[model samples]
Target: MPSAQSAARPAARSAAGVLGLAALTLLATAPRASAAEGWSLAPAGDGRPSFYAEGAPGTVLQDTVSVTNSGSHPVTVRLTGTGTGTGTGTGVPVTFAEPTVRVPARTRADVPFTMTVPAGAAPGDRSGTLLAKDADGRTATARIRLHVGGPALSALTVEHVAVHGDRITYDLVNRGTTVLVPKLAVRARGLFGRVLLDRAARTLPVRLAPGTRTGLSEPWPGRPALDAVDIRLTATAADGAHDTAGTEARFVPWGAVAGTAGALTAGAAVTVVRLRRRRAGRPAEPPPTDTYTDRDRDTDRDTDVELTGAVR
Candidate 1:
């Protein structure tokens, strides 16, 4: 039989082991117990994001925010904001009414945030914060800076399809972003509005001066004959590039007449010259004036009469 002292010692060691394990389990599940206990909101370095435009009451603008856990634990983030670059992007009762997102540890999550400015929201620079909260109710913040410009650029009008013979013309104005590098696929329509030209260029380098605009006038074949035409511009920029603004213009087919007329006259002149040269190449006719005509005529007649009689 074991002594009581030895028995007590074994039991004590077992109890100690169990208690130690229980403590470890508690530590593992407890919400971050320290000041450094929460997950951080890491941006994939999309330079400070913002959307600013002058909007009327009840304007809805949408934007996307990409987040990274960048920590050892999972993270949950909330979104709230108005569309324009300014004003209480976040509503007054301001809370991102979205279910919290669980960004996996060391992974990424692309969260979409929407902002609706109140009908009477004043214009200017309005700002807010996107809160990234952890399970522990701890948070990291990303500042949301927005601007309310004079107005949201709604429609674009690109006009003046000056046809220099077969070349098309363009004048791309970003009415919004500073400079937009766009892709150009020109579709030309006729009087019946049928597509006469449909072609795609991988990329057209567009550089527009801030607040001003850029213009291009290059002609392409298969342009439909219409009083005016519609040009659709699709532009894209990188992360650091400016906004994506699709624009169009109503242009007049004004100068195409001049080009067509000039082409015809030039063609006609070439034909006239060719005909004159052909006539000049034929054999020349001798002078019709009678140098020996009368005398030769009479002599030839008498000789013919005499020769006839001799033969008979």
Candidate 2:
């Protein structure tokens, strides 16, 4: 039999142990919840996932980004803009009003920013990111897409065309305000108007931005061994962009030609030597002699005397 006071002591100890276990569990879960509900960054207004802007070149576009601190502690973060996609330069020209912001617990900070379209920016879409980083090196990002407005012009040119052995090389230039994926066609004609090569137009594995140039080559595996060829390259892109360039190449068998030339030179030398020898070996001609001997003189005199008597 136990005393009531002792029984009450054991019950009180059990109750206190249960209470302590409950307290420990609560302490462990509280920190996890706080860490899980950490900070975030997003576009300022509405529920849009990213920021978007559109304007003409040499114009300034404005937008806002938000830094939120959902935990019980204050958060200080730094904001920056990183450029992506095909744009004028490496980074988007993002200028922030407050580059650094301090958000109170359960509060949000709105930061205003301006992105300037380059004066010579081509008409196309550019993208970037709005980034926020804290002292703990934790980072958050929000995307921004920008479109520049202008007349869409498509122009291209092929240049520096040349043939090297079994390959034809050329450069493609984008001269317009838009991006271009070019298609190439190759044609070659021999000296006698025969088509040596005719390759249909096919898509090239490159993208040409405005005012960009890229060098490319085409392979001609079974090229003519000896022929004078004219090679023409035509490049085309969307929106009526087109250009053509050409070059001439002559392939000669120099070794065979040299051998034939040497043989001909040797034959000419032999012929000249033979003619000289024939002339050198010929006998000399006899000296001229007067046939007017004493007999001849008497006959001429008698003829003259007869002629004179007849005349008389």
- Error (Å) of candidate 1 at residue 309 is 99
Off by over 4 Å in 2: 1-37, 86-91, 264-312
lDDT of every predicted structure (CA atoms): 0.46, 0.75
Model 1 spans > 4 angstroms off: 1-38, 42-45, 49-54, 77-97, 149-312
lDDT of 2: 0.75
Tens digits of per-residue lDDT for model 2 on 183-262?
99999999889999999999999999898999999999989889999999999999999999999999898999999999
Q: Give the TM-score of candidate 2.
A: 0.72
Best by TM-score: 2
Best by lDDT: 2
